[model samples]
Target: MTHSTRSSHPRRRTTPRHPVSPRGLRTLRATWERQAAEAGGPGGFHHLHGPHTHGWLLADAVPELLEPIVHADDDPLEPTFFAHLDAPVAEALLARFAPAHLVHRSNGSPTLGNQLRATVAHPGEITLHGFVLGPGRCDERLVSEGALVRFEADLLVTEHHAPGCECELLWAYAVDELGLDDAEHAPHRIHRIHRAEAPDETWWRLLWA
Candidate 1:
């Protein structure tokens, strides 16, 4: 009867889509198993940004390394909000966002090569992170059918929650390609540091805390 803690069932989440950069972890897992079997799945595959996904996430350093670790607001490193259609109008707007989730930002740090900056948070009731780079698209499937698709990151944050309540925007992209002075996070590459520290709201108490 020592099972006072039975009826259990709560643990299911495995998300690892190509991320091996410990100096090319076994040649990047054999080139991500041959690019996920020639892009059959494994999420399209594409992280050759830095010396191949952040050159071992910046080998070794020792200064305030790896920041940013937001809690809510989906905080997945928030980015991918879009607009400034450049590269061939962003590939005809990714043929209707091609089922997207994006969340951009990746000048490919490890010393900034690809350069990134994305912020597109859309749900409803007005929420805009870089509001799709502004200049248009208030939502219509993201400009009349183009959900959102335009990569080539390299910037850092973005804001416009004006009316002065709380918009502590801080831009700092390609932080010298995130050459962390002291790093860690190589259990197969997955980042989002900062750990703790988030208490200062305003914009309606951070949109209702």
Candidate 2:
């Protein structure tokens, strides 16, 4: 019964503009594994990466925290809500919902003032994808409260460009609302996968691969 307060905006096309071939998908997954291994596993890679990040949370918390702005008009699991959030509130929410294996990215030096902030691209689109992960495999899952959520946004990057560049940003989190009895259900982890200000070349390659 929760209602979303944010006004509607254009939804991004579900299909990728440049779809990856089956081989490309394999290569992309391999590269991700290699990068993760080299960087001391996924936790290390996330830390070494730039400011963009993602994380996991219990699906139930989504309604509790964002009830005012997460309407049930659509698939409750795919409810659209505001991405921008207050810094303290964002931090507290993450802390409360984070799983034991959730490794937070380093915010870099305080003197440089490069801390991660909760901001979103306005005049753009937001999209979500769902997946399920087991010990050594991952498979797409229908968008649901119990599935892992991949949150992505396409927005303009104006920081260093007179004419802003359009780019994609991504992050992910997991939820377990189904009480699935499987021991290998996806882990509850959240990670910031990419940022517009500093895009990861590898991620771009994978997208276009």
Candidate 3:
């Protein structure tokens, strides 16, 4: 048998190019990782939405802005980047992803709620299901199991049953504690406010807020 000659140079590992966040996506990733590790099980990534989905969407839609949340070994249903979401966190995320005047798509009606107004009116009560890029359809994909959201009075989100967390609490906090309507940067102050006044620290610490 003839011996084959090998090259001296080592092959370089190829990593796919992704989006980037100005604040450094690694901070978000680190926060989730720490939260998960501290929780001692799967962390906050246990739910359908929450921090895992937040990271996933950022990575998927704008990978160049932040690192990807899901890995090759990640579970399709339960991902691996968990964190408790409170009023400030939810509001910040909503501001980042679901802006104020985004076109609403439910039942194909032009008359619907705008994201900002509804969120402002009712904090923490809105939890978006399905991908944000596609048309809102009446199918299993857009409307997942128990992820129903109902609106009242045109601007307030009355009821919300999301997959992983209780968003209504956050909304209540926004209305009661944060006074989101008056403060333009209320979302930015959620963490501090939550740390100070949340009634159930155990629940907030144990699972997604």
The number of the candidate with the highest lDDT is 3
Error of 1 at 100 (Å): 12
Candidate 3 runs further than 4 Å off: 1-90, 93-101, 109-113, 124-126, 134-209
- Scanning candidate 1 in windows of ten residues, the lowest lDDT window is 62-71
Model 3, 128-172: lDDT tens digits are 222221111111011111111222212221224335434445545
TM-score of each: 0.15, 0.22, 0.22
In the range 143-199, model 2's lDDT, one tens digit per residue, is: 212111223444443433235444222221111221222223222332234546435
Backbone clashes, candidate 2: 10
Candidate 2 ranges with C-alpha deviation above 4 Å: 1-62, 99-209
TM-score of 2: 0.22
Q: What digit string (tens of lDDT, one per residue) describes model 1 on residues 140-180?
A: 11221111222123223223433641222211121122222
lDDT of 1 at 205: 9
The alpha-carbon lDDT assigned to residue 107 of candidate 2 equals 22
